[model samples]
Target: MNTRMNSTASEAAHQFIVIEGPIGVGKTSLARRLCASLSAQGVLEEGAQNPFLERFYRNQRAAALPTQLYFLLQRAQQLAALQQQDLFAPLRVADYLLEKDRLFAQVTLDQAEYRLYEQVCAKLDIHPPKPDLVVYLQAPVDVLLERIAKRGVDYEQRIERAYLERLNEAYARFFHEFEAAPLLIVNAASIDPINNHADYEELLAAIRRMKRGRLYYNPLRSRGI
Candidate 1:
């Protein structure tokens, strides 16, 4: 998903916000809710439009290349459009980050395929709009698999637990090295930011208070405070 950053003068701190997590972590739902709260534009991934997604889910190895390519092109186009115009000028809250594409490519692609993918990516010249803040949702692999089951998308039924574990680890590695913007890591296992109001409020407060570097919004750990 691609989002724009057009914030109210009151919220200069969060013009562009990105909510990221592994699959089925409710990050997209949080992004939409944040858009409502901030009166910002909502950018969602058009995953339904990806013809190869279902196939990729069914056969990741067989379909990884096309699936990745489709997503790459789609996200590039969406972000490029964001670059072109801001007439609507809605503040931006998005579910996905462009840089994370390489994470998936690394996990799913073999060496030669990854090489080709990188070459194509360089050609696309993707310079994503820098988000003012990134909200990363984290949950245990078991929790992720359970959520995926609860959602019950047809193609997602084919997803394996091993893949989820691997994806989670990859995300961990990426965010560990991430230094592009202010980072807010949320322990999504214990709190549901999408459905629980108290949790959401706590997260909102954390967002308001964050000034620099990496911060965490773990309510369970803050019980004593």
Candidate 2:
């Protein structure tokens, strides 16, 4: 825990942090761990509990708009609360970024629908606090599918392999050009941040080393185990 990276991350005065990745890449789990370590507030995305989610899984074309709308409204409400209150502690970790909302819209909606969605989003005036650090987790689609299956969410059981593949690609494309904050791109395919203290330590170190711009982390090649 006293590693250079860990020490640096601890010393830094970061008010906002975001852990982002495709589904089942463990963003929420990492955010939880980070919040615990930092003694910070954690804002997690409420996934699948939305009534429209199961229907979207069963019939994407029929349920896409409603599912998207539900998520948008829920996220907006959360952000509104943050705006009106002392939502952040000395440090704060959120599992989702408001901008990432667009990624789903682009992926799940048709051209016309997406255009309409964008129009609505443009009017929301929701300015999320910029993260001091944005950790982008990456893994193969196969790994994502495996993790999702292991999690045993009944509605997610029917998640098509093709959709997962597309989502993976979309995430990759989004993060490739992402520059909203200091970025740490982590290869999570072989790294288990939970139940793997070494992996978690390495990640903490990597975050500290991130000073500006973007950095890449392949846990397969970390030092001094």
Best by lDDT: 1
- Estimated TM-score for each candidate: 0.91, 0.90
lDDT of 1 by residue, 1-225 (tens): 223335443366667889998999888888889888878777789887899999898888999999999989999999998878776555688899998789999999999999999999999998889988898999998899889899888888788999999999999999999999999999999887777788888888887777569987777654342
> Which pairs of residues have clashing backbones in candidate 1?
41-91
Best by TM-score: 1
The CA-based lDDT of model 2 is what? 0.84
Local error of candidate 2 at residue 101 (angstroms):
0.8
| Residue 175, candidate 2: C-alpha displacement in angstroms | 1.0
